[model samples]
Target chain A: MPENSVICLKNIHKSFGDLKVLKGIDLQAHEHDVISIIGSSGSGKSTFLRCINLLETPTEGEIWITGEKLKLARNKKGDLDASDPRQLAAMRARVGFVFQNFNLWPHKTLLENIIEGPTQVLGKSKDEAIAYAEQLLRRVGLEERKDFYPSQISGGQQQRVAITRTLAMDPQLILFDEPTSALDPELVGEVLGVMRDLAGEGRTMLIVTHEMQFAREVSNKVMFLHQGQVEEFGHPDQVFGNPTSERCREFISSVY
Target chain B: MFDLKGFGDQLLAGTMVTIELALASLVVGLCLAILAATARLSDNWFARNIALAYTSVIRGIPELLTVLIIYFGSATAIMAVARLFGYDEYIEISPFVAGVIALGLTFGAYASEVFRGAIIAIPKGQREAGLTIGMSPLKIFWRITLPQVWRLALPGLGNLFLVLLKDTALISVVGLHDLMRKTTEAVSYSKEPFLFYSAAAFIYLALTILTMVFIHFMEKRNSRWGDK
Candidate 1:
């Protein structure tokens, strides 16, 4: 592992009973590396991102987050599980996840949703969490809607709030699982703009997205996943401009 | 024509007792239902089986029979235990206490199924979102999951509560001076069974109507964050 590596996954494999989803994949992300993961719908891009946080619990692999390894054991059901629950939670605390559907708590207001992680899990004082939450909400241009419920907001605004909620944790790495895929075409740019700004500020981000052009413009590196493996990984220019793999070239051309 | 002057006060008192019994049992039953529903949804095999057994046994028995067993059988069960310590004094259980246990247990059995369905109705992503944010499982259930569960379970619970209120009349069979018992006493003395029973029916109808109004307000309150 590199000294500055933020997340490293080695030989990750995942299976759902008879179906093998992720076949032996490895990825090492360094500090300030904004990587865009692009592939077809069933190509395992979301599963790969979920594995980093132990959400899916890779069937066989080594996951080291900032030099600390996640220990896994086979439970009685023969499925892999984090050996130590506290360790898994502690590691998860350092990572943020934004879902494709913008899974905000519908019962809570926008401000309360953002401050929940900091106050409940991180143990920040109410006043402190509120202050930081206000700052994040303002950045997303959602300061006025802080008191509104998630259902009352537009889809694009809700996705931005979801990102802001993840950012409230002040995590070392953030994972975006098709964050804007559920948004309308006109609303996609607003969410992509927030993500692009995050990349500009040197946040470590792993985005599984279907936006080919946005991925090319915002990401320092682009990873093309083909059948649960890293078919092509390099600078956006190299991977998108001139891919070496025939499958990679074909996939890129199809998307473009 | 019925003369209400003789037993009007007694019937009103019985109505109060009936209301108290129903409220107490409802409170206890709601707590039990939440606990049982949580157990049913838990991963522990022992707890799941225990909760399943409780709901199954209570729901299978007739509510009146449960009241009778608790009222009549409790004294024997208590004395048998007391005999173990050589203190064999006969003890009597309060009819109110017995009534609460019987009705609460029955209500809980049906309501727990309602609660379980509500918990399942919530989207899986809500829990996953909480888990990925590093919240403990307990915190996720209380802070994230339970509030939503209550919203989803409100209408079902409301119906169960109304049934629970009416079921309190079953306690009258166990020698408690509830609305039905007082009305029966009045009728026997007055020989105007039709008039006294009609009064009792009116009282029950009033209570049910009041309860429905309260439930309507609750449903409205819960839907505040929902559709515009």
Candidate 2:
């Protein structure tokens, strides 16, 4: 692992019964590197991203973030032990994830949704949380719609708010799981634009996306996963401009 | 010929008791429903099984039968225990208390399902998002889960409450002077069954209409954010 690497996944393996979704995958993400994982649907790109945050625990392997190996173990009686709830919670706090569905809390106003994490999770004062929420809303260009509910906003606007909600957590790493897959084609550009802005601002991001243009343009590194393994992993230009793997070449051609 | 004025007072008194019993039961039922729904979703097998059994047993039995069991059977058991302890010769369970317990238990059984559905309707990602932010489970329930559950469960819960309000009449058999019981008493005394019964039916209709208006206001207030 590189000295500057913020996230390291070593020999990571995950399976759902007999179906091996992620097989012995190793990945290292350095600070401020926007690593985009691109592949066809069911390539385990999303599963791999979810495993990084322990949303879905790996069946076998080690995940290290900021030099600490996250404690993922079962008890003698074969149950998840409750002793490390704090550690698990702390690990989750450092990694924020955005879902494809823009899963904003429907009961809360846009502003409340944005502030909820800061107030409830971080124990920030209500006024401070609100102020930070407003800043994030403005940063994402949704300040005018801060009072609107998720159901009231357009897909593009809702995605932007989802991004702002993630930013409010002040995570060291942000994971995007097909962030634009649920948006309309016309609305896709707006969400991608926000992501592009985040990339420009040097935010460390691991994005799972189908948008070839985004993978090519915004990512510092691109990894192509086919059949539960990283087939090609390198700079965007090296992989996209001149691919070594026949599968990578075929995938790039099919999409482009 | 019936004396209409005297019959009206007795009916009014009965109507008040019925309303009180229904409101009390509804409040208690909603509280229990939330707890049971939470337990039903818990990972612990004991908690989940207990919640399931409570809902199943209450739902399977007829409401009138439940009332009879609690009012008669439980009262006897309680009096026996009291006698053993030498606290009193006979420990009487009031019909009003029995009615509340029976109705509330039944309401809770139905309301648990409604609450569970609403909780499940919320996207799993929202709770994940809450956890990432570091909110304790209790705070998450209040801020993230509760508001959404209330919104989703409103229609189902409102319908249940209406049914509960009508079911208050069943307590009349246990000798609690509810509206239905009052109507019966008034009819027997005045020898005018049709006139008093019609009055009682109208009262129920008026209460139902009033409940609808209140529920409409609540739904509108709660959904105001969605319209923005």
Candidate 3:
């Protein structure tokens, strides 16, 4: 309810054909907050991240992005859809999403992939988008690989490019869905390093991750979700070092 | 003996006509294939069923029969429509137009299946990436979906193009003066079936070889990313 809140979810609920995945969850993200969502595999972590952008439309809830509430109504398909498509698209533009598998468009080069979202969606000129893309690629130590296909690069490098691609949009919020889960154990560290840099820059990010160490070190606030509800949420030290809920304690002990 | 000097000009002209017919039908067939594939994959029940029926009926019949039906059958239907409008000046379709329509319809039916498979092969996350970036649906198709589909469909579509090229010979039966018809007329006049028909066969082979070269070049250029 504060003025600085960038994302607010009130009573978020999602179900798939009688199977309720996310149940009545409420969370608020303020400016420059790096919130880490950690949970077991089937605890609706990925689905919750997708719902933030209406990728998997929430069955019942109101999602406010930077204080603008999304308009939703039931369509003939008996699923909730946005009443105004243009508004929905505009809302989506305000947030960025990074996938687990690093879904870079294979036909285009790294530079082209990075510039696509900024030029195509943000209405930035090609020259401007290219310049920004080059800077971001350089930051990720990938300026030399700008012309390479995603398949030609290592999985870690591909994920870095995926992050740069999302960063080029300059979105208010960046939602990461298991960004390093698909990478090999050796490659996971490189991706986590890049994310640590972003968190240092005070970016508003919500990452659904299984990396317990990264969650503790990189995020200011950590949320422990269990069975589609927040079991514990507080500062990283309090939640991880001293979890209040029995389930949270059990999850942390099992993982660590 | 061969009348190379005298009828060489006619053969060349017929070859040009055949190339033009093939290109026109290709353009028409591409449009038809895109429309048909979209309909087949779409959510509309009526559109899907209509597209399914079209592809099934066209694929079931022989290409030659489809050409015949499009040529004579369309003429009959058009004449009936003209009579209803009280215009009886004997409106007839040009042979070139009829050949293009007939051959193009058959090419489209076959190409639709290739396109459908290509579209299905693309990962769902590609579209989600586009949507997250706020690209319009039409823009997404042109930018994201089209390039991948073209890459995936190239070899299959290249094969279909060859089949479409050879099918132009069937148009000669409707008297479009294509490569085969020119060869037939030249044979009748010269009485040297061996030389004239053999020359025509060589010309068809040359055409195929040249087109294959272009297709081969395109395949090489586009496959660079797949090298790894």
Candidate 4:
């Protein structure tokens, strides 16, 4: 792994009993790098993104964030360490994750949803959290919709709010699990636009997306995942323009 | 052989008692229900097991048996405690208190399931969002979980309340002057069982209708927040 890498996953393996999902995967993301992961459905792309945030615990291997090793402490028997509640909580706080379904609290307004993390996790005062919430909502072009519930907003708007909710934590890294896949075709552009803007501001992002055009336009590097392994990874042009691996060429052609 | 004046007084008094019993028990039952549901979902095995035991025992027996047991059993227990505390003389447990305890216990058992379902129905992500926002578990339960639970559990709670209202008649067996007891008393004096019983039935029907209207209003108000 590079010394300045923001995230590093080495020899990571995950499985669901009889079915293995991620097999000996090694990947690294540098600071402010927009890395898009593209793969066919059931290709373990979502699982990979989830593993980065520890939403799904990997069966084996290690994840390092900003140079800090995320290791499961084992007993004398060398069994996998089952994380205690406190450790799991601390790990979750550093990585902000946006779900594909825009899992906004249905009971809270957009403004409340954005303010929740800062007040709850960071223990910010209510007044300060509200002030920050307003600023973030405005940045997402959701100032007018602050009082609206999640059900009242469009999918694009909800996704933006979800992003702002994560940003409230001021996390060092952000993970997007098929962020725009659940959106309507027309709404997809608005969410992708917001993501592109975030990329422009040099935010470190790992996005799982099937949108080839989006991958080409926003990502500094694009990784094509095939059957739980990285088949090809490089600058968007190198990977998208002239494919080296047969698998990569076949995958890109199929999508096109 | 109808004693109109006596019937009027008894029926009015009974109606008042019925309302009081239902309202008091409803408040107490709901409070206990929330506690019981929280305990059922608690991390500690002792608390969860205790809550489970309470629900199971109460649900297993018939309502009449429960009412009788609480009425007599609590009176004995209270007197025993009083005796231990040096009040050796008779400590009468009032019929009103016994009725409240019995009905409240019954309502609480059903309400526990209602509360549990509501709490479980909420998406886990909502709680995660609550934690991420810096709300302590207590604040999260009150602000995020409880409000949504109330909305989701309203219909079930309404039904429970209606059942509880009807169950107030059970208190008549304990010498409480609720609708059923008063009706029986009026019927005996007036020698007109049909008329007084029919009147009591009408009153129950009216109360049920009023309660349904209130429930409808609540559902509408709560749903408005999420509606576009």
Per-residue lDDT tens digits of candidate 1, residues B1-228? 334858998898899999999999998899999999999999999999999999999999899999999988997899899999999798889999999999999989999999999999888889989888899889999999999988899899999988998999999988889998999999989999999999999999999999999999988987877755
Give the alpha carbon lDDT tens digit for every residue of A95-190 in model 2: 888889888888888999887777766788999999989988888888988888788989889989988988988988899999999988999999
Off by over 4 Å in 4: A1-5, A66-84, B1-16, B31-57, B76-92, B124-142, B182-196
Per-model CA lDDT versus the true structure = 0.91, 0.87, 0.89, 0.84
C-alpha DockQ for predicted model 2: 0.53
Put down candidate 2 lDDT per residue, B15-89, tens digits, no spaces: 789899999999989999998999999988999999999999999999999999989998899888888888776
Number of the top candidate by lDDT? Answer: 1
lDDT of 4 by residue, A1-256 (tens): 5457888988877787768898878889888999999888888999888776555667777777787676575534332343454554555677778888888988778888887777766788999999888898899899999999899989999999999998888887888889998988999988988889889999999999989998999999999888888889999999999989998998898888
**Candidate 2 ranges beyond 4 A from true positions:** A1-4, A75-83, B1-4, B7-10, B83-88, B136-138, B225-228
TM-score of chain A of 3: 0.97
- Candidate 3 CAPRI category: medium
B106-180, model 3: which lDDT tens digit per residue?
Answer: 889999999999999999998888888777778888999989888888888888888888999999988889989
Best by DockQ: 1
Candidate 1 docks at the CAPRI level of medium
User: After aligning candidate 2 to the native by TM-score, how far in Å is the CA of B79 from where it should be?
Assistant: 2.6
lDDT of 3 by residue, A44-120 (tens): 98998888887888888888889888889986756567888888888888898899998889899999998998888
Candidate 3 to truth, TM: 0.97
Alpha-carbon shift of residue A231 in model 4 (angstroms): 3.0
Quote each prediction's TM-score.
0.96, 0.92, 0.97, 0.85
After superposition, which runs of candidate 3 have C-alpha atoms over 4 Å from their true positions?
Answer: B1-5
User: What lDDT would candidate 3 get against the real structure?
Assistant: 0.89
Model 4, B84-171: lDDT tens digits are 8888776667778888888898889899999999999998867765554334568778878999999999999999999999999998
Clashing pairs in 3: none
Q: Which 10-residue window of candidate 1 chain B scores lowest in summed lDDT? A: B1-10
